[model samples]
Target: MIKGIYVHIPFCHQICSYCDFNKFYFHNQPVDAYLDRLDQEMEHWSRKTDLSEVHTVFLGGGTPTSLSLRQLSKLFDSLEQHFPIHQITEFTSEANPDELTYDKMELMAARGVNRFSIGVQTFDARLLKVLGRTHTEQHVERVIQHANDLKFPSISMDLMYGLPNQTMDHWKDALHRAFQMPITHISAYSLIVEPKTIFYNLMSKGKLPLPAQDLERDMYDYLLTSTKKHDFEQYEISNFAKNGLYSKHNSIYWKNEEYLGLGAGAHGYVDGIRYSNHGPLKKYMSALEEGNLPIIHQNFVTEKEAMEEELFLGLRMNKGVSFSDFKRKYGNDLREIYQSQLSKQIQLGNLEERDGRLQLTYQGRFIGNDVFSEFLL
Candidate 1:
């Protein structure tokens, strides 16, 4: 059952240096036409699949709030018309601090949007500029304040560490300011300069001055300690939340559950297959216009691949992977399948078996990518 729906709005007012997501500048783009095509795509999907009441509806970006008030209204109107929302417990939209205005916040609240995932990046003005983020620290403060005032059910912010010239004190300041807000969730990530991003180009030319691996690890340590001290549970490696405030939409992905990925550049898993839509705007819109699903690539997940994914994705959570659940799902014991890998990881102090679940140890969280790689068949 596809219980979650992710709608991507790939339009941004300004591009971030570290971002590599498929998006175009909001100025002078065919914004209304894109939304119309999105509506048509959703309608076509509904007719094909028995999709009605989803548990979560997430409108992520480039920046969903970049749309005009009228355009936002039209987008939601299409959503409500095609997709039922009364049963959606968590309806989220990602917004940038500068563009997420008071009026837009009000519109979201009125439209049953319960969660706002704002991109704060960092509180340091210099770092913000280096990251090519246009929002100021003041803008973040004001946007978060407005969201709090409106009493949005969940207010989550994205923060990044391990930037150029960023120190422990710099990280501490960002974390300190984050906890000061009346927010429920915080997702902190180490900056990775992916290929094709501005940061990547600068790094290639020796112009980027990112922190060392050890310093980045130290920053992650501080993040864990500080968030825990503030009574937030580290539900996943990078996600911390107050009691019962876990992001339901994100959890759907971590649990490897089925979801519908709508819009260009979106990836989704349904039944036993994983699929991605076309990333380019022209390819996406043209497919939809020609009464096609716009799916550029898809693969049926083999049982072996599914089990491998189960370990990697499930281990991202603090609870790790359940031994019994794995056995039940695959009709085979996990230990029997990867005994050598499990024994090696445990011997190396990177993993442990506790409470009938195989999970990453505290040490393993720091080198999570390496730990997850061991599970690959």
Candidate 2:
């Protein structure tokens, strides 16, 4: 079954310093017009693919909650026109706490959106100012409570570490705040200053005081210990979820399953063809208005590339990869394909195989990207 669909809404209230996502500062002209094209794109794509099998739909951002209820309803209405969408199991939308309102939450719930992911980067107002986040800690708390009151099936909060002027105590407080809600998932990510972000500019000017290497690692280790203590499973790198509450749409990406993506700057793969949408709203809308598919590029995954992706992504889970499933899917022995890397890692006590399961050792998980990089083909 086609188990995942991702729709990117590329508008945000304002740009954040640490962000480099495909987004524009919110504007009246572009936001309304972009939704129109997104509606058309969905209708056209439904005719292009047998989309009946889609089991989950995730509306991600920029910030999907930026949309007015009317805009969101129009978007959802367009989809219902083309597909039997009620079968979609996990419908999620990303929200920033400032954009979340009781009416918005209630409206989404009525429209079958069962999951919400709040972008609560930090509760520290000073840190939020540095991060260019518009919301406050109290906003996050209220939004979580509001979603719980609305009976959302899943609620998630996103946190970040390795910021300037952060301490272990601050991080611990943030984790504590996360637990105060009935949130089923929390994602904590390290702050990596990408070249395009405002942080990178400050860093280049030597105006930003970054945490030292030891402190960064300490942040990660602390989160690991704290989450496990709280009974939140560290399923993927930077993600903690309560049992069975792991993001179903995100799993499709990590598991390398087929999915369709619509809207500006979205990426998807199905039937071995991977493609991305045009990033600019003007470009996307023009193409859709002309009744043209807005895909800017595509690559057909070779069997070798597919197998390599499967291995790299599967290892992200704590359950690891089943040797039987690997062989069953690829028609090749896992031991043979990864023999050299596996042997070297096992000898170094970084990787192991036992009882038909292949996974990284505790030591290996810390350097997982290193292990994953070995399979890059």
Candidate 3:
């Protein structure tokens, strides 16, 4: 069943150096037209599938907060028309601190948006500029204060480590400032300069100076220890939550569950097929205008591929993958499928079995990508 819906808002007031997501500058674009097409797309899908099972709705970006109040209302109206908005258990919208004003937040709250995922990469002003972020420390604090005042059910912040010229003190300061806020969740990630991003170009020219591997590992270590001290539970490798305020939307991806991905450049898995929509605005809108679904690529997921994905994605969470669940889903004993790979990782002290579930060891998480790759058939 498709239990989650991801709506992408690919507009940003300012582009960050490290971000490679599909986004256009908010100014002078056909914003209203795009929203209309999005509505049409939703209408098309609503007729084909039962969206009542979608308990989680996530509005991610470029920056969802970049939309004007009227535009947001229009988007929300379309959502309510197609999906059971009132029945959604968790509704999250990603916002940039500076762009998300008090009024915008209020509009979201009135429309049933219960969670805010604010981009607060670092607290240091210098690093903020380096990351091409327009927000200051004041902007982040104000947004958090506004969310608190609105009594939003959950407030999450995104932080980055392993930044250019970023020292241990810089990371510590960012974490210190983060903990000072009354936020419920923190997602700290190490930077990976993907191709086509500004950071990638700079790195190609040797202009980017990233932290050493060991230092980056140490930074992650500090993050785990500090978040634990602050009474946060590490639900996933990079996600920490307080008061059980886990991000239900993201949990769907980690569990390899089916979800509806709407908007240009969005990807979805439904009815055993993985698919992606057209990335370009023109291609996406033109398809919808012609009464098409805008799907550009798709593949039927084989049972072998599904089982491989089950291991690599499920192992990211703290609870890991259950042996019984695997058997129920695939009708194959977990030990029999990948016995040699499992044995090798267990012998290397990188994986362990507890309570009939397979999970990554402490050492495995640091080299998680390496461990996950071994499970690939």
Candidate 4:
């Protein structure tokens, strides 16, 4: 049974320069139609499987808060009707600082949305402009303050480092300012310029000047140290939480559990197959209108692939991969399948077996991509 649901809202008020997610400008789009199709897609899922009360539901975007107050209400109502909201321990929605108003916050609270993940990329004005973000530092403060006033149980914000013209001092100042907020979670990520983004185009033209590898590493180290000092525990590589407020929805992905993915450009894993829906808006809506799912691709995982996924995905968490759990699930010892790779990583001082789990050491965290790559068989 799927324990989680991820709904993709592909509409954004403004596009950020570095973002390459599946999104479109909110203006002049068929917003209501898209929401209707999303609802239909959920209904489609109910037809295929016994829709159980999901543990968590996350509405990620193109800025889900970009919708008008009425639209947001309709969207939430539709979701509650399709997915059992009463059983959800966590219901998170991504919001932009500028667009997240008090009315929207009240609506969210009334509808049982307990968590808010606001996009506050950087507190610096210059860096914000460079990233194509329109919100100022004041907007972030205001939105977070309002969310706190509403008594939302878990508040999280996203920050980015390793950007063009970003420095250690800028990063430090941002971190200092973030700790002042009433947020319970922080997700700090290093910038990666992907294809089809403004940053990628600028780099091709010799216009972008991102920080060096060593400086980026310093920023990451500072992030870990600072969050730890602030009484926040690092749960995942990019995620840190105060108290025990780990993002349950995201944990599902890292734990390699099944989830239902709804809306355009969403991907899902159910049974043993991983599937993705049509990315284009028109195609996604038209498919639902014709009473068919917009699934464009589906891959049935072989045992070998499943085991490989178990390593890379599980290793993403600080708790690491469980040896006994792996053996119990696969009916084979983990060390026996990749003895050479495990020994090599251990010998290199990058991996350690502790508390009946195999996890990355401090050195391995720095070169995590390389360590994860070695697990591919």
Poorest stretch of ten by lDDT in candidate 1: 45-54
Runs in model 3 with CA error above 4 Å? none
Higher-ranked by lDDT: 1 or 3? 3
Per-residue lDDT of 126-239 in model 2, one digit per residue for the tens? Answer: 999999999987888889999989888899889999999888888888888788778999989989898889999999999988888788888889899989998899988778
TM-score top scorer: 3
Error of 2 at 236 (Å): 1.3
* Predicted structure 4: lDDT: 0.92
Q: After superposition, how far is residue 117 of candidate 1 from its true place, in Å?
A: 0.8
Residues 98-194, model 4: lDDT tens digits:
9999999999889989999999989999999989898999999999999999899999999999999998999999999999999999999999999
Distance from true location, Cα of 285 in model 3, Å: 0.4
List candidate 1 stretches off by more than 4 Å: none
Q: Write the per-residue lDDT of candidate 1 for residues 24-68, one digit (tens) a residue.
A: 988888889899999998998777776654789999978899999
Error of 3 at 58 (Å): 0.2
Greater TM-score among 3 and 4 belongs to 3
lDDT digits (tens) for residues 1-377 of candidate 3: 89999999999999899999999888898999999999998998889987767899999988999999999999999999998887899999999999999999999999999999999999999999999999999999999999999999999999999999999999999999999999999999999999999999999999999999999999999999999999989989999999999999999999999999999999999999999999889999999999999999999999999999999999999999999999999999999999999999999999999999999998888989999999888
In angstroms, how far off is 59's CA in candidate 2?
A: 0.7
**Model 4 segments more than 4 A misplaced:** none
The per-model lDDT (C-alpha) reads 0.92, 0.86, 0.95, 0.92
